[model samples]
Target chain A: MRKIGKQEIEDMAVGAALLGTGGGGDPYIGKLMALQAIEEYGEVTLLEVDEVPDDALVVPSSMMGAPTVMLEKAPSGEEAISAFKQLEEYLGKKIFGTFPIEAGGVNSMLPFALAARLGLPVIDVDGMGRAFPELQMVTFYLDGISATPAIIADEKGNTALLSTIDNVWTERIARAATIQMGGSVMNAMYSMNGKNLKDSGITNILKLEEEIGKSIRLAKENNVNPIEKVLKTVGGFELFKGKVSDINRKTETGFARGVATFEGLYENKGETLQLRFQNEHLIAQTENRLLCVTPDLIAVLDAETGLPITTEGIRYGARCVVIGIPCHPKWRTEKGIATVGPKYFGYEVDYVPVEDLAKKGVTL
Target chain B: MRKIGKQEIEDMAVGAALLGTGGGGDPYIGKLMALQAIEEYGEVTLLEVDEVPDDALVVPSSMMGAPTVMLEKAPSGEEAISAFKQLEEYLGKKIFGTFPIEAGGVNSMLPFALAARLGLPVIDVDGMGRAFPELQMVTFYLDGISATPAIIADEKGNTALLSTIDNVWTERIARAATIQMGGSVMNAMYSMNGKNLKDSGITNILKLEEEIGKSIRLAKENNVNPIEKVLKTVGGFELFKGKVSDINRKTETGFARGVATFEGLYENKGETLQLRFQNEHLIAQTENRLLCVTPDLIAVLDAETGLPITTEGIRYGARCVVIGIPCHPKWRTEKGIATVGPKYFGYEVDYVPVEDLAKKGVTL
Candidate 1:
């Protein structure tokens, strides 16, 4: 796993920001916060999920709310760690480690900040390995875990404990709270013992993020398409390259939900692709056929810069490239599909690997 | 605390269905499944939150999904217990008791079914004490608990664990999977030790639900407005009595989000009110003024029958009474307001207690 230093964090943020596309929220504030943390606490140590002891207490830290609000509002950086400590006390156990919830935007660095301050190791893995809109969307959820007794702490040292019936209620309540807290709140959730992690957790997602980030940096240095490099690293497929022709967006329930239509480029010329986003891309379609849906990663990037464009950043006339990556193999199982497939997103589309879709010459 | 029998389950479901206000989804399937489990397992024992040891492991059981689909596709009944067992093994600890995530419909009885079979006591307290749409919208959340390592078990014996960055992701991933699992999945989440329960949980919510249910029954028999009785029990303020004039809804991200407009009656005549819902009534507004929002309890009932209305069941022409109950005083604190008030739900309005709103001389 890559051991990220203060220097690497800036590069990683640049890369993470690129992957965030426009909607993962601004990585600048989070980047600054994490860098400050690293400077104060020294470089963060990254460990694989399995490296955790059977009894280790692992917690994830993140910022919740609209990306737009985060840009305008600076975080106090005390909430996540405070929430973590509160939960640790609630469980009557000491926390051993911390980790990111995803590999996108501000969240990608939240764990880093917590781990640094707590003097604990941060896992290279993330629950999602990517970003998703809701609280329950993670590989950990697929592993049958709860995100309860979650501590949501605002910048003002005010903290609340949310124990819900399910993960979604936590989201519903937390989302509202985050908005009220001025569109952002640092949260510590999904606390689990190491025994549970050994069986259910995905290992080394932070390493993956670093790898993806470094590869993009390398691609830029070599003057190559960072998209191609990412696809190769993740074994993803190039779905389509195009210029954004139309964009539609609206903030619902404090989240950016919208659609983008792409006018195909290069070999994909004359074909059109429509993509939908809710924090992260939910679906990609070419005319009548739905191409890739949730569980699988549908990412849109600037053709020139190879930076990811989030729904919040999507604008008319932006030239972009749409790429589809295969989700974790586990997500392809019948159980996995039921948990995160396009059908889960209200699309009637059946599950199909992005690579297979590419091989079929069905452009999306 | 009430030791509920199968008969009480039915009445609770009926009452919960009303409180759901056309949105909690039909609790019919969840009810039937819980009934079958209870019949097979026998009667469940009840325990107050304070009765347990501080270290006791308490797990919550419920169904997560679109309530609309719940009516069409029923649960298999095997999942809740299965999920509970999986969590137990993962934690390497036996659960001391079971509890409902909320005290409405099937979720109210889910813990009882499991409790009977597992030979454990069912906690009389629930997270919300009422029904809410998302997984994390619970008093426990306000108390600073996390809902990670949540076990989501499908009917087909497939169970997944999710530990998200936050409760919101937990909901997003779990809901997506629930939809893929054919619309409904039995979930046991927000497992916590008793110490956390006492610190912030809404203790005795199940008992309160039972009392409310029984009081409603007694009130009906006594020719009293059961709605008024409920209001008195919770010390809530009557907001308005009206007939639903318009309902606007759309299914987005698998949730039914919409608004219902009401034409006031009696002293509220000529004044109009609108109730917003997303699995639960989130806000009530009268043009420029806001009446109530989450963390506080908003219940809609049949004016004539004094029955609650589910979020999905809101319909035009239905005569209803909208009542606003103050949430636990804890929710009104700055921390609490940051966690559950209207501002959290994306409104710019300040939080005003239902009692205070009533004292303002607003017509109801």
Candidate 2:
């Protein structure tokens, strides 16, 4: 195990925002929260998944709701502790460690904030290698892990402990309650033993996020193009370079749902790109080609700084590079595709690997 | 203490419906559920509020949703038991008895259904002497009794255990989850010790309901007009006699909200009565005069048989008699009125006791 100091947190936030794919909340806010916690409580220990005993219980600490709401009403830190305490009380056991449920600006950094205060280790594993909008869109869910016996606590001192028949039901009920609880809540869910985590989780996610962050940070000093460095680090393919033309967004049913349109620049001047999202970027397409779809990670990066821009941060005139990375292998399975593929998100496209689509110019 | 059999269940259902004030669920369905439970589990024991020991734990059994939805999706007995079992586990104490949270057909009789199955005593007490739409509109709320550590369970085996800052948050979160869970769910909330029940609850509500039911049933045998007997038994006043003219209802946001209009008949000819409700009747008015308003009870009954008709049961041409009864003295307090008053429900009229309104002929 190693300590996660302020520098690690700062780099991780940048990388986490990249992996968040335009959802998971603002990285700046997430960084401030973690930085503040570590400032007060000192550095938190970071444990590899295998460091936890087979029987020791681990839970992921994350937030659920529209990212826009979270921006205005940042958590006060107490809610996360309250959720963990409530879950422990109900489960009749102490949590051994905590981890990010998904790789988002807020979600990826939240565990560190919580771990610092609670003195719990931050595990290196995560449920999703990249972010998805709904709670059940995780590799753990594909492997049949239950999300119930879940606790969601709001900043207002209100909480709801849900026990649902399936992970989907948990999402439906929890999402509704989240909206009523002021559009955001801290969740202590998917409590499982180390054995289950090692079997189903995407391991070394934090390491990869930190590496991605470090690559972006050092690019300027090293006299290398930051976007090119990021692309090389993540093994991602450049889909398009464009200037934002328009964005249509609205917060509805506890989700930030919208589409962003881009006018291609430089190498692909005539093409128009459309990116659709529900909390996270789910689809990216150009006029005649399907660039990428869900179960694939799509991220928007500032062309010069290589810093990821969240869906809410996309400005009308911003120039950006859109890239796609293949999701974890677990999401390529038939069951995984059914859970979060294009069809599940209401797109009619069939499942196709981003690598294959990048190689052969798949027509929409 | 006494044994509550099928006969008592049948009588209590009618009385509960009248007290529901056209908002509680249908008495027929409530009677059937209690009767079926009694048939299988044998009679449930009824305990007086004073009979319960001060330290004994008690919880109320009820349902929250649009009444229209409950009609289509009746709860399986398993949901109620699941809710109770979950709550008991959370509190780490055995519940001594169960009581009704409110005086509605389904709310009142649900206690007996659950008590019989669990072999627990049914307490003859309720938080509301008359039904109100929101969970916090009760005497218990006015007395500062908490509704938390509450559980709401759906027939599909999903349950939510909520602990909120206050009862109002409990209602808001639970109602949203209920809608997601399937529009209706059984609730186990407002848990308190027996002493709190004695102090805050309306005692002997079951006995009074049974009497009302018995009076209606034996009216023909006693050779008296059922309406007159009902008025005498409950000390209520006739507000209007009318034939139903129009009803505009829609179930939205987990509440059955609408208005029903009536064309006057007999002594009330040429007058039009308008009744507005959200789960329970909240107001009644004529063009120039205000007839009744909550927290006073406004019930609609069959003009001939004196049987109560639920908001969902009101038909376009049925002859009916609207009656008004003074709520328990507890509900007349400043807090109680503010909790369920006309203003709270978005009505502009000031609250006047039904008796005062009846005697002075209050203008709109």
Candidate 3:
């Protein structure tokens, strides 16, 4: 377990932004918040899941709202603490640790702030191990953990506790509350004991995220293709390189959702790629076939700057590269396909591994 | 409570169709499923909450999916039963009765099938008295019952048992599974013991639904305005009477989410109303002020036919009447608004009582 310095966080901010693949929201604000917390409480220990005691009670917490809104309505430091403190009081147990929800912009950094404030280690793992739009779209769901008794705290010091019958309702009701509270609020949810956490969480995901982030930073500094470094670090497959020609977007149910139509810029020039997104890319469709599907990580990065572009940030005429990384092996099984594949996103395409798609383009 | 027969079932179906507010899909299918189950088994007894044994283990079950899909792909009756049976096994206890998750549309009738097949009585109550998009967006969620141990059964006889840490995860993961299986799947979730049921269930909601359904039927047959009858039955307030001039819809995050813009047709001509919806109506806004906000049920119905228009069914040139019913008084409290109100849905407007809105000429 490494004790990261303030300098590492700066590097992480850059790398996290690349891994965001255009939609984790700006990491700058969350980075600042986390840095301040670390300064106030000292360095946070990043614990691997194995290092966690079998009997320890760890809760995964973060902010749940519009990232676009997060940019406009910055979170007060109090909210993160309030959300965590409320859960601690409700459980009548000390929180042993915390962890990032994903390896993205703000979400990746938000947990570190909580851990620093609470003087607890941040777990090196997340449920999805990647970003998803809704609170319920996590491996934890597949593993049988509930997101209820979620604590949501707004900037005004008003705190709300939600214990739903299911995670979807937690998102639904909490979403409404977030909107009511001005589109963004800090939430600490997915409370569970260590036994369930060990059973459900993706082990060492933080280390993986940090590595993914670090590789991109190193690649950028070396003037090499960050995409290649990402692929090497995560075993991701380079799907296509293109220039974004047309971008269409709309906010649906508070999700910044839309599509980006890209014209191939490299050897694949004149070939168009269409990527659909709802917070995160779900599908990458070419004229001939579907290249990447859900559950697998689909990201689009600026060809020149290597900056990740979010759905809301997509605009006309941005050169980009599309990459696909294989999800956890468990997500490839029948259960995984049923939960987060192309068909799950309303596409009629079958699940195609990123490696296969890289070697042989998907058609039909 | 009145014992529902085949004849009453038909009337209830029609009433539910009108109450569905252009969503909830077609009630005919749920009616058919329930009728078939009752026929294969026997008549289902509807017992008031008070009549249920204190020790009776009542499970509130509903099928969570897109209503449009439910109409296309009829459910195999086995899923609910399988879920109930599985939950029974997990609990190591026999379930005494069943109840509907909601008392409107297909959800309202599904419990009958489970009760008849299980030889258990159906309770005269539900979580939401009307329809909602996600399973977890229920009153039960506010009351603190988990939707876990949820059994999701597909038409292919593939049953996935999910035990999530929260309800949101339950909905998210299950929804992914349902979409992968096809567009829709059957779910028997929020299985609660009678003690929990008594504590969490909305007492007498089934009876209220029946009464609401029957009143609409009687009003229609008597050539009276069914909307008025509905309002009188539930003390609802008229929010707006308008013609749907534009319906903008697109699918996002696996949900048919969009906005329907209405132009007032009668006394309020020249005024415009926009109702934003994901699965259920989340916000109602006019040019001047917020007409109605969530947590207060906002339903749209055909002005002439008195039939409800679903969010998906809303189209250009449709004459519609928007109604705002007071959600259960429990929802009007501070906690309730925090859980289900306009603020809950991300509206800047403060929650105005439905009755107050009616008196304020749609500007409240």
Candidate 4:
């Protein structure tokens, strides 16, 4: 097991924000929170799913709601532990460990803070290798794990536990609660045994975050392109390099969804790309065709600092580079495609692997 | 203590509907459901607060959401029990009895139904002697009793446990859940011991319903004014006796709020009166003066059958009699006025006791 300290938390925030694809809420505040937690509680232990005992109760959790709202009404840090303790009390069992529900955005750092506070180890894997908008959009859900019997808690010491007919209902019910609880809440759910996590979890997510962060840092030191380094280290594709020229944002059904148009720079001059999002960046499009679609990774990073720009923070003048990575093998299956494919997001086209799209030059 | 049989359920629905003041949702379905449970599990026992053991766990329950939705999507009859059982499991103890959270519409009968299913007794008392729209509008809340740790369940066997700072947060969180769970849900909350109920409850509400029903029935048989009989029985006042000339309804913030206008009939011919409501009849008015307001009762009953008309069932052309009952002495307190008064419902005028208005004779 590895110990995640302040430095590791910082690096993971950078990497997770990149993987956030412009959603999953803002990571800056979450990073600060985690740093404070580490300062108070020392290092957090990280355990692989296989290393945990078979009887261990592992809970995966994240913050649910509009990322922009998180910036305005910050979490009290106690919200997560309140939800966790409520679930523990209700189930009449101790939670053996905590883990990230997804590997992207603020969620990826919340568990670290939670682990430090609770004095528990965090599982080395995540439910989703990257973030998706809805609570049900997770690899564990796709693998047949239930999301019910979940606990929701707000800053005001209010907590709710849910056991829905399905994960979809879990998302629907929890979203409403989150909205009513001032548009943000911490959720602890999908209480599975260690054995189940080993079977369904996206393994090596922490390691992947580390590699992505390390690669970017090294590239920066060497005066090389951070986007190229991120792509090479994670086997991702550099989709576009551009300046954000136009953007549109609207909240629909309790989610912030919009499009960000980027004007290409350097060799790709005069070309434009559009990124569509609902919490998470869902689709990347060229004028004529789709460049990439989730559960494939779409990361938007600052051209200079190598820092990631959250969707809520994406303004009209920021320079950014877009990168795409192949989803985990599990998410490439028929059911996975059905859950988070282009069509699932209301796009007309079928899924085209990001690697295939990256080979063609911007010949136009 | 007494056992409430099928006949009592029937009578209580009638009286409860009168007290609902056109809001508590349709009582017909709940009445039928209670009858069915009585057939299956025999008559449910009813316990007075004073008769219970101090340590016995007492849970109050009701349905939350738009009553109109409950009409289209019939309950599975297992929703309340599911929540109850989940609470039992969570508390790690057996709940000795159940009670109505409010003496409004369907809530008045749901406890009987749930009791029959769970082999538990229904308490003779409730948190509210009559219904108000919001969850926190109960006497339990007004008396400083917390609404959590609460449980919410859907027909599909899903359950949620909530722990809020106060009853207001509980209502806010649960209302959102109700809306998402197809606009209605069964909630079991305010789990207290017998002593707590003795302190915060509106005692003998079931007996009050029984008295109201018997009074209306006797009035109908004797060919006397049923509204007058109701007033005498409950120590109420005749707010207006008229023909329903105009009615308007609109859903706001998840509660059906509207106005019902009545043209005077009989001895009070040629006068006009208006009854305003949000879930329940909250205001009684003449052309220029306010007659009564909540938590005082403002019931509208059919002129002939004396059957109460729910707010959702109020129409443009039904002849009706409006009766106003004095609020419980508890509700006469300053805090109670703040909790459920004309001002609380966004009215311009202050609250006036019903008897005072009835004495002045609808003077021009």
| Candidate of highest DockQ | 2
Q: Which candidate leads the pack in TM-score?
A: 2
The residue pairs in collision within model 2 are none
lDDT of 4 at B304: 84
Best by lDDT: 2
Range of the 10 consecutive residues with the lowest summed lDDT in candidate 1 chain A: A14-23
Question: In what order do the candidates fall by lDDT, top score first?
Answer: 2, 4, 3, 1
Q: Across residues B1-364, which tens digit of lDDT does each residue of candidate 1 receive?
A: 4466787777667655544544556667666766776788776677777788999998887888765565665555567778888788768899888877876555776666667767788876777656667787777776667777777766665555655556766666566556545677788778899988777677766555655677778888998878878877667778888999999988876667789999999978887999987666778878655677776778888898777777666788999899887766766788667765677767766667777676774333
Q: What is the alpha-carbon lDDT of model 3 when measured against the actual structure? A: 0.74
Q: How far out, in Å, is residue A249 in model 2?
A: 3.1
Q: Where does model 3 exceed 4 Å of error?
A: B1-364
Cα misplacement distance, residue A159 of candidate 2 (Å): 1.2
Against the hidden true structure, what lDDT does model 2 obtain? 0.90
lDDT accuracy of residue A64 in candidate 1 = 81
The model with the greater lDDT, 1 or 3, is 3
- Cα lDDT of model 4 overall? 0.83
lDDT of 2 by residue, B214-268 (tens): 9999996787789998899899999999999999999875578899999999899
Pitting candidate 2 against candidate 3, the one with the higher DockQ is: 2
List model 4 lDDT by residue over B1-364, tens digit each. Answer: 7878877887788888887777887788889889998998899888888888888999987888876777788887788878888888777899999899888788898888888888888888888788888888878877788788788887777677787888888888888888778888898889988888898899988888988888877788898877777777788777677988888889877777788889989965887888888888888888876778788898888888777887777777888888888878788889889988888889877777778777864333
In candidate 3, clashing pairs total 35
True contacts kept of each: 0.00, 0.96, 0.00, 0.96
Q: After the best TM-score superposition of candidate 4, give how far the Cα of residue A55 lies from its true spot, in angstroms.
A: 3.4
Look at candidate 1 and tell me the lDDT of residue A236.
72
Q: Rank the candidates by TM-score, best first.
A: 2, 4, 1, 3
